[model samples]
Structure formats: C-alpha cells, structure tokens
Target: MSIVNIIEDLNPWDKKLHGLFQRQSTEKLTLIFTTRENLDKNSRLRNELFQRYSVPEYIWAKVCLRLQGYFGAEDIFSEDGSTVESHVTWFHFEIKYPFRLPKNKDRAVAEHQPPTPAQKDGKKPAGYAWYKMGVVTSWKAPDQHTIIFFDAEDSPAVGVRNELKCNCENVKVEPALRNPYWAHQFLLGPILACYDEAVWNLRDHVKALEQGRREGKHTVTNSLDSNDRDLNESSTTFNALHEILRHALHKTEILGVAIQTLNSICARKKIFEEERYSAETVAKEETVQNMVITKRCARKIAVYLDFQLSIVRSLEARARANEARIRSEITLAFSTVAQLDSRVQAEIGHAARADSYTMVKIAAVTMLFLPPSFIAAIFSTTFFEFTPPEGEKVSKDFWVFWAVSIPLTIIVFVGLYPGNRGLSVRKHISSAAHHKATTVGPTVASPAAPAANMV
Candidate 1:
C-alpha cells in the first residue's frame, strides 16, 4: 500500500505539528488528533476525540454540508486522499463565514436533517434525522493542500468542543496535544481527584473549627508542625497559621477549576467515542458506557470544582473574620483569667465554656441569692423591732443590723454557688489554654524554675 501523504507539504500543517503528535498515515491526514500518541500509532480509531467546545446551532449545519460535500468539492473532514492545496482552498472558503451558517441553500437542508444515532437518541427519527455536534470533517482540493476542518467555522469539532469544559482559547496546532504541567501526572491524581482533596480539606477544617468554637477550645485557625499537620498552637502560632491559609486559598481555587475542567474533558471523550459509530450498528455498548461514565464523571468533577472555588473564596473572607474574633476573645479571656479579679473572670469564662446543664445550675444558684438579699435590704431599716433588739432591746443599732444581715448574705451566697459546673467550665478553658501554652512552652523557662544567675 502506498503511503498516504495528504498533509505533509503545507507549512501550516508543519507549524501545527510542533508540540503535537501526528500519526503519519499510509496517507496524509490533516485533521487534528485526540492525543499526541495518535500521530505515532497507525491503526483504526476505536476511541473518539474529546469535545472541548459547545457549538452553536447554525455552524453545525455548515459542518453537515461540508461533510456531505455540498460545496461541490471534497469532504472537509474525510480520511480520503486529501491534499494540502485542498486544505488551503477550504480555509479560504471557511474564513468567509466565521460565525454564520453556509450561504448555499442545499447545505442548509443537509445540516437540518439528522444522520447519526446521537441525533436519534433511541427514538425513531421524526421524518428528519438530527445531527451530532462534534464530528470532524475535511475538505480536500486538487491544489495538493488538505484543509483541516476543525478550525473551519462549519466543522462540528470546534463548536461541539464547548460541551467540554476546557479552555480552548488560541488553540493553534501543536506537536503535542497536552502540556507536561497540566497533563495527567501521577504527582497528583486526575485533576478532578485533586480538586476533591482540597474540598475535603476545607470541609474537615471548617467542621473542626465550628466544634471547637462551641466548646471554647481556643482552636488554631490552621497550622502545621514539622510533620505537616495542624497541631496545638499558641496565639502567635495560630496567627501565622491563619495567614498561611489565607494565601493558599487562592492557589486552591485555581487548581480546583483546572481539575474540574480536565475531568470534564475525560468524561466527554467516552461519549464521543460511542458517537463515532455510523448508522450501521450500535453494538459497542462498552464504548458508549465509557463515554457516558467519563462525561458524567467530568460533569460532576466540574460542578464540585466550581463549588469548591466559590467556597474557598468566601471561606477566605469568613475565616479572616473568624480568626480575628477568636484572637480578640482569646486576648480578653487571658487578661481576665490572669488578673486580680481572676475568679470572677473565671466564673464568666466558666459560663462561656459550660455545658447547658452547667450553665443552668450556675444560673439557678445566682438567682437563689437575690430574694433573701432583697428582703434584707427592705427590712434592715424599716423594721424597728428587729432593729430595737439592736438598740434598747439589745442596745444595738443599724451597725448591728448590718452586722447580722451581711453574714446572712455571705452565707446565702455560699450556699447558692454553682460549685461543680463553674469549676468544670473553668477547667475546660484552662486546659485548652494550657495545651496552647505547652505547644510553645518549650521556648520559655518553666514557671516553677528559678532563673539562672548571670555572671
């Protein structure tokens, strides 16, 4: 069999070949490929290329006419012996209607009529077969140039690519169809999976923070030890941790979008492969399944990625506010706990940390003292009998009345105090602060140890 050289001679084709892989045919094939490997391996195509676009309805019609050769010329997306000159001629024709449907009346009809099963969707056609959107076609001419139809305004390839969630901007021909940094590298799983990891991280972090906030744990915003995980931290350490998270949120969002888009591309590849079949047979169920699965996976991944991006952006704002809130509370809590009014502050702090049961008990005890104190205040001076025992009745006065009233008040307060609940809450808060202090405590001398004498 003679070598097919339909696309080798053109400078345009050659330029497109760099960073791109082309499978040299026993014949020349000017059409773009699904992967770089396609250029080197010569075989029947069982897998269809991924659609990286979503074509509008009108251009789809022109592609149908071009495939049917309504231009009175070679099919623009054929595997036939297309020459470089034909490509040049097609380019001239296609550039005319960059965004419009073909001017030819017959082409308009062919595009309107469906020919593929994808258009039928398991239902019998209603007099007219619908068209599949992304099928690649070629137009060849006697000028020895084979025109690739993917870039043609009429070709379904570019338009259908929109179904794929990738960025196809300025997509010129290249020797390779992918970039090393962006390719399916093992360093990270597929792009979709990577996005999933970030989402998980954000979710878990938020959950933990909410729990800590409720419990008065003095939780660190985000942090890392030498082992690369968040651990206990001082106020300073947590401050640094929040700053780092704030910066990473940006990077995480960008990666999330990219991963989602790649997953979508992978998914679209499966459906496209099944759609490659002609009207003859639909037996390749596995191929159909693969495409459908990949498409679904891609769609899901894109959704999550978008969601993650949005969350991270908003989370950045929220976390900043939250971190500041925590920091301020911590500062105030520390000052209160350490001052001369420490027990009073501890009571407040205890209430802050107390369980519902504990808070209820403390509240009950505080309220219990109010009535006796109020009664004493009202009767201390008004009741002369009680006071006379202080004057002539016992030669006592207001001082004596106060003397008895004050002791009774003290006793009442002592009896009504919420002993356990207040203590439990105070312990919980101090324990959290203790953990924070210990994490950074190594740098400082112990409170129990005396300072070393200086020479």
Candidate 2:
C-alpha cells in the first residue's frame, strides 16, 4: 500500500496524459478510453495513469526504478487486511555470474610479481565477480492485478516476457476467468522458465568442468608414464573451475530462496481464500471456484519448486566430484615434480664425485714429479759439482742436460693431463688404420693387432 514516486519530475510544458477513467453519477455512468499514442511522456501524467488504473504501489516503484538496488532487498512479500484483500511478492533472479574482464591496464599490472601494496590490501582486482540484478514484482489488489518485470540489459527477463505473451495467447477462457488464468500462467510459466534456463546453464557449466577433469586425469596418467608434463595449465583450469562452481552454488542458493518465497505466497493465498469462503457454501459458488483454482495453482508451483531443488542438488554433487578430481590431479602433479627433482639431485651428486676423483689424480701426479724436479734443479745449479768419475772432468756442456730435461718435462706434462694422452693415442691409431686401408683397398679389415699394440 506504500507509494513512492521514482521517476524524475516532469517539464511544465508537457501535455496531460490520457487514460481509462470511469465515473458513476446519480443517474448515469461515464467511461473514457485513451489510446497509446495519446499517452504523455511526462512523469506527472504517467503517475496519474498508474493511479487511474489502480496499479499497486510496489509494482509502480519496481518498474519505474528498473529494478535497481533490488539484489539484497528484504521483506519482499507482504499481506495486509484481515480478509487478505491484498498481497505483493517481489523476486530477484540472476542467470549468470557477472565476471568482469581484465582491462589492458589491469593485465599489465598483473605481470608484476609480489603484487603492489594496494593489491595486497584485499581490494578486489579488476576481473573480480560482479552481480547482475533483475526483479519480478506481482501485486494482487481487491479488483486489480499487476505484474511488472524490470531486468538488466543482458538479463533473461525479456525472454520471460515473450514466453508470458505466448502463454496468454494459448489459454482459452471466459472474461470472468481471464485475470485469474493469466495470473496463474504468469506465476508458473515464464517465472519457472527463467529458473529452468538458469539451472540448465549451471548443469552445462558443471559438465564442462567434468570434461576438464577427465582431460586432467589423462594428462596425469601420461605424465606418470613418461615423466613429462606441464602442470601449470591443468592447475589454472582447476582453479578457474573452482571459482565458477562457487558462483554457480551461490546462484542456486538465491534460486532456492526465490522458490521458497513463491511457495509461501501461494500457500498464504490458498489459506486466505479457504478461510474467507468457509461459511459461504452454495450461495458463493463463484468464490468456491476461484478458491479451487487458486489451490490447484499453488500445488502446481510446489511441484515445480521440488523439481528445481532436485536439480540444484545434482549440480552440487557434480561440483563436489569435480573438486575431488582436481585435488587428486594436483597431488599427482606435485609427486611428478618431486620425482624429477630427486633425479636432478642424483645427477648433481654423481658429477661432484667424478670431479673429486679427477682432483685426487692430479694431486697424486704432482706428488710423484715434484721431488725429482727439485733435485734436478739443485744439481744443475752452478754451485753444485757434477763429477762423472775420478778420470772425467765436470762437463762444461750443461746445455745438453737442459735440453733433455726440458723435453722430458713437456712429455710428462702432456701424458699426465687428464684427456691429452687418450686423444693422442686415438689419433695415431686412426692415422695408421687410414694409411693401411688406403694401401690395401677398402674391402680388407684394418688389423686389430696393430691398433691394440699401439694403444
């Protein structure tokens, strides 16, 4: 019964709006009808039209506001009067999770590691989830009924409106039954269809997650066999699926609340009608018929609500299964990474041991040659007397000894350096084999005895 004007004030120069008006005088009755083309665009005229038609305040406000700020609305359904002469129910529904795409600037910022202080402060990122809002308001007056739908630009409410029109056309009934018939159809048809479409979309999303899980399992199996796979892609897909599932679950919760509200409204209407007509009996056959119709409509709505709940349960179960599968895949990927790490560590250990062995060999060669080299240097010094025998003088040609010692030192160094001796030996053997092969022609096998002796 509360009325609020949500439309902007009208311009003074706008013409008055024309609408249906009825007046009953003492001796005569008058009825005036207006066409759509004659309706004014001014807010005052629009308000007058609504008042004239007896549109409920709630429906008027919802439509005028375009359902804005209705997402978290409370006390959406209310009944008034002892006889339940009036009632209103408003419902909000969203078919999809509104996730914003990251802007180019956001993407560039995301590339930096150890995110900025602002990001670490728990602020929502650019691509975070947003909520779309849509509303359906239904009001039943003593002699008038109104159903107003306000939805976001991308919402399914438009589809529901089209479906409602189709349902209205399909029903055949007398004028007296027209309002009640359309009311019931509006409640059960388009409203139910909206929820049904949302549920179907959720089911499809869950199926996609299941498919991704299967693919992850295959990747895990192949990785176990070959020890080659990139877990990053699988990990990212799993996380994204988890996020989507969470959104889907939230949507289901909202739908459940909406369904419960609808069921409550129907139940209250049924009870009110039965109590209002309890004493009337045969005289109020029309009232009885209306009561019966209301009760049947309530029952049909209850059945649909139960079916929707079942679908929500199924979706939840599938989401849980996918969660478990993703967890197992992640565990397997970690194990594979661990195995690879262990292999790398083992290789490092082997290399370290080989290096230590080479260092030890070099130390041993140095120890074997150091004392002899020191002794030869000492004897070759001018201070040392080198007497070959009693009859021989000390040799004046010390250059001969220098030439021999220098060449011998070079030979020892070339032999003892780790890979030098083996390379030289292999080279000489290959040269000899090639020479033999050229002289004897390519048909004969090079002699193995010569190569072995040379080695």
Candidate 3:
C-alpha cells in the first residue's frame, strides 16, 4: 500500500490510540513535548513532519505501526538506515521495554473469567507483552535544531520532561536545554532506561529460576514417596527454564542492537561535526565544546549499556547451569527407578520358579499315592466282596457307600479349589519371613534344607 494510505489506516495520531495504550498497559505516562522553540510557528518543519519529512516514507510508516501495537519492517532497526545528508542527519531506530498488563477493568474481567486454558494456567491472554518503541529523529545542521518523534513515552522521557519543568527557573538548566548536545543526550535517556529495564527483568528471571532449581533439588532428594511425580515436575521446570532463556537471549540481542545504534549515532555525529566546519568556515569554540560533551555523554551511556550486556550474558550462563543441573537430577531419578524395577523383576522371576517347583512336588506326591489309594478304596467298598462265598457277589448296602463317597468327594474338592487363597498364603509366608529376619539373629540352614527345597 501507499505510505499515505498506510498511515491513514494506522491513524497513529488519533487520541484513541493513546487511550488504547493507557487502557492496555500498566505504565502511566506524561504527555510528550516538543523541545524545539516556537514549534507552532515553524510551519515548514510541521509540513515536513506530516509529509514524511526528509526521512523515508517507510520510516514514518514504521513509527505509525509501532504506535498502533504492530511491528513494521525489520530493516528499519539497522544503523544503515541512519544517514548524514548535506542539510539533515537523521536516525531511524527502535527501543524496546518490558510490558505488563494494567490492573484495570479489563484485568478484573480477566481474573473473573478466563476463556482459554492458557489464561487459566496463569499465562497472559496475549502471548507476549513486549514490542518495539520507535523513534525517528533528525538534526539539521543549518538551523542548529532537532526534530524528533517518539511513538510512546517511557519513564526516562517523562522524567526528563518533568525535570525540565521543575528546573525551568534555573539559569544553568535553561542554557543546557538550548544546546544541541542536550537533544542528543536527551534521546539517549529512553534507550538506556529501556535497556536497563530489560536487563533487570533478565536478572529477576534468573533469580526466580535459581530458586526453582533449589526447590526442585529438594523435591528430587525427598522423592522416595513420589518419584514419578517429582521427576515429571522437574522435567516441566527444566522446559520452562529453557523457554525463558531463549527469550532472554533474544532480548539480549535487541539490547546489543540498541547499543550499536547509539554508537553509530555517536560516530556519525563526530563525522558531521568534523566536516561541518571547513577552513573557509571556522568552527565556533562553544559549538566544538558542546560536540565534545555530547560525545562523552554518549560514550558513558555506551559503557553503561556494555555493563548491562555483560550482566545479561552472565545471567544466561547461570540459567544454563541451572537447566543442566535439573536435567542431571531428572536423569538420576530415572536411573534409580530403573534399578528398583530391575530388582523387583528379578525377585518376581525367582518367586515364579519357586511356585513351579512347589507345583511339581505336589504333582509327584499325588502320582505316588494315587494308585494304592484307589485299590484300597475299591477293596474296602461295601459293593465288593473280595473273598465271599456262593451268592455274595454284591452287598445290599452298596447304595450307602455310593451316597457317602459322592458327597464327601464334592466337599473335599470344593475346599481344595485354588482361588485367591494361594495369594494369601504367599503373603503370609512373606510376612513371617520378614518378621523372622527382623526379630531373630541369622542362623545357618542345614545343607539338607536346600536339597529338600529343590526337591
């Protein structure tokens, strides 16, 4: 789409956009102010600002997009887009800060009724709250003036403006605001503040992770009662830490780019100052001094950012170490569980073999006695007479023998049926062995006992 159409669709300057930002974000901001004197009288600058200025249309489009909560082109973030024209030196860069949900009516609704499973699990309805805060600034050497735009106000911007208001009567502060160096340094405030906050968030996240790791260690150490549950929880913690670290690393990259952008601006400004005055046009001493001061301040800010970057790196290392520690603990828990399972399985195999041996012995005993018992039963039966004379082929009381044998056989078989009764016997035997092992001293078994057990 054309730039004008895009900007119109975005409606960046709409008051409703500010209201939307206020309603959704937890941060309270003061109104953004233009530092240039008589901005209303400068119709040319106003026209330039609204008509894409000397800067690219894409730059304006990006600023508009970020103002409306959408990220524009990635190329806009690069220092390569920064230019030093004959009449104007301008920068197109971005700043990012941590975002939070506002505790407003919307927050109340979210708490009262979560519509999604993720929200119920304490995650934000919107997956992430961080986005780019765009800044488009241009410095005109001819007029010794700057024109800047910020899509949103952060603490640093608000604080700077507030300081300007509070010290308006101070002669010292008034002169500083007029100096071109002040504008350059002023712009650095929000960038540094946002980076500092990003690093702080990283540090706090690392701290929380350390705490969680310690808790996980305690859980793993005392996991004898609930090994599976503890291990699963630890795994989940590790996964969460991994995701956080990934995000932390990404934020660090953004921070690094911010620092780079600052340095690039400083380098270009130095070049502009050096080349702006030629042998024909001598440079003013005050102007030269201001340029030097601006350079120093920028360097100091760079140093501060470098320190924060180091902290972020250290935090990343610490988080990785915690992740590794939790992973090892989980692995150890799994190994312990595996060993216990192996031991139990071995014991089960031994029990199966013992039961098979017992069954074989019982079968052998039944085989040895069954034939003799059968012959004795037949001879003792009243239905048969082994050595009887003439007509004693059968006894009249045979019916009595049949009735008694049938009923007794049914009762005996019923009582001997194998049900859960075997399980109970095995349990009793185990308990008795356990009790004996605990109560009595160990005693040597007879060699014949082993032989008898095998038999």
Model 2 has an lDDT value of 0.45
lDDT of 1 by residue, 1-455 (tens): 33123222123334444432244233222333232233224222212111111112233344543531211112223354321222111111111011111232322322212122232567743221112112233322221112222322222323322322133222333212211111112111222232333333333344444555457554332221222232334444455435434424533444433434334433443343234322222343225654455445444544544554454455445545544544454554345334524555667787787676677676766666665666567765655544354237554455654676667767655555556755776788899788767765667556765554110
lDDT score, residue 362, model 3? 86
lDDT of 1: 0.36
RMSD of each candidate? 23.9, 18.6, 15.1
TM-score of candidate 3 on Cα atoms, chains taken together? 0.45
Ranking by lDDT: 2, 3, 1
Clash number for candidate 1: 56
Q: Give the Cα-based TM-score of candidate 1 against the true structure.
A: 0.21
Q: Name the candidate, 1 or 3, with the larger lDDT value.
A: 3
Give a tens-digit lDDT track for model 3, residues 249-362.
Answer: 556555555545555655554454454333333343236666566456545644554554455455445444544544554565457556656766888899999998899678
Top model number, lDDT = 2
C-alpha local distance difference test of each model = 0.36, 0.45, 0.44
Q: Model 2: residues >4 Å from true position, as ranges?
A: 1-82, 97-133, 141-144, 152-155, 171-297, 308-455
Point out the higher-scoring one by lDDT: 1 or 2: 2
What residue pairs are clashing in model 3? none
**TM-score of every prediction relative to native:** 0.21, 0.47, 0.45
For each of the candidates, give the backbone clash count: 56, 0, 0
lDDT string for model 2 (1-455, tens) is 21111111122343312312233111111112122223333456546645543444464453634432222111222244233333344444434432322221322221111121235568755323333333333333333334433332223443554555444444333332312212544444555554444444444445555555557543432343332244665455556655655655555565555555455544554554455346653244346677667456555654655565465455445445544554554565457657856767888899999998888698767845764586578776899666566676666656656776667766665665546566788788899888866765645445764663432
Best by TM-score: 2
